[model samples]
Target: RRAAAAQGTSLYEEEEILLALIGGKDYNDDSKCKKKLEEYCQGLENASLKKKEIHEKLKDLCEVGKADTKCQALKTKVTKKCTDFKTQKLEQAVKNPSDDNCKENERQCLFLEG
Candidate 1:
């Protein structure tokens, strides 16, 4: 209908517009099928718009090593932080439970110091 309005022809009369509006196996050019195509296009447009909007919302404007002060989502914030360090620490801590040097250093130089 929109294509027909835009170019003054039915969807079939405007071959390119019809094809452009239609996609893969989910919809065809029959009566009910065309209705389905229009509905799918609306849904696709809405989802695309939402994805673009979410990309904008999740965007971080920080330099290297700087946390996004305003980004409060734990999952997203963790993506920006160093998880490699946590994995490395777990590997080391598991491999040698009695590594006093690492433990003592962390005790004095890490949270204990702060």
Candidate 2:
């Protein structure tokens, strides 16, 4: 998306596949699964925004020749948040594929393997 690009971030290919899957779903008012998926995905998006903010701050600090330890700490936080979000999403997709609109794109749910 344009927003992600503006933030100097990019979605992974797997996320694109996931998006295609979600796009195919019927998002009616009665679809509790869709609602839940939306909420979960929203959380992921917020996490991504936070990561981007951290990156921007780190860039600013680097430009000013700040402490390496501060940058390292921020990088660690970003890495942990990214890892946790990915793991949670993959597990959700595998455990509730339909809820994630992944039923039709099951093959793309690599997390389901092993």
Candidate 3:
């Protein structure tokens, strides 16, 4: 719980729900689940960093009066892509909660929703 909290994600709740769904059976090893959660958190952090970088770059461009059509288009495209991806993942998770892939989708959706 501390680790997930440090990562700025509520993964402990997700883990508990996952464990319940699996009838309390461990995922091969508890460490594997922890490792996976850590990886997911790291991935989320990296994505946020990238988003910040993009925003900063865009801001810098605008401040210098060089904000071009392409830059705005790219930003809009990226935003749309992110929204579409989240929606798709959430729909997949909701449509097939019992599928193996949907378990991962659920985690991704939960993180994105948060």
Candidate 4:
């Protein structure tokens, strides 16, 4: 759907701008970065849970023929976006290679694997 595609494109563009802004800053404190990453991961997890809940509700509606195909499509889009964000953060952690960043990256890997 053109609307979903447009939304994805806008989301990607917005994330790019946000990353650009963040990359411009000099993070001398690894603790701060680690804290931020933790918060971000938590937020991502919460968002994923909320999306799942919404999908289930929509699925119930669909079963009654009250919902359309857009619900699943939106879930897919959101999952992809979250994945893209995680990948980008992992790449940044690899580039920095701080102790905290490494731990965070490992934690993320385990989280993803599990």
Which candidate ranks first by TM-score, i.e. highest?
2
Can you tell me which runs of candidate 1 are displaced by over 4 Å?
1-69, 72-77, 80-82, 99-114
In model 4, what is the error at residue 62, expressed in angstroms?
A: 14
Compared with the true structure, what per-residue lDDT tens digits does model 4 show for residues 55-79?
Answer: 2322232233222233324334445
**TM-score of every prediction relative to native:** 0.22, 0.30, 0.27, 0.27
Model 3: weakest 10-residue lDDT segment is 19-28
What is candidate 3's lDDT per residue for 11-38, written digit by digit as tens?
Answer: 5343234332322232234454344434
Report the candidate with higher lDDT, 3 versus 4. Answer: 3
**Could you tell me the lDDT of residue 54 within candidate 2?**
41
The candidates, ranked best first by TM-score, are: 2, 4, 3, 1
lDDT, model 1, position 86: 51
> What CA root-mean-square deviation does each model show from the true structure?
24.7, 17.9, 17.4, 16.6
Name every residue pair that clashes in candidate 3: none
Tens-digit per-residue lDDT, 1-114, candidate 1: 343355553334422222323322222223443444445446556766544442232222122321223222322333322254356564666677765646433421232122
Per-residue C-alpha lDDT of model 2 across residues 1-114, encoded as one tens digit per residue: 544455454433333233323322322222442443455446556776444554332223322323333333433444454466558665666676564355333332342231
For model 3, the superposed segments whose C-alpha errors exceed 4 Å read 1-63, 66-71, 98-114
Candidate 3's clash total is 0
Judged by whole-model lDDT over C-alpha atoms, candidate 2 comes out at 0.40
**CA lDDT for candidate 3:** 0.43
Better of 1 and 2 by lDDT: 2
Number of the top-ranking candidate, with lDDT as the measure: 3
Candidate lDDT (C-alpha), each: 0.36, 0.40, 0.43, 0.41
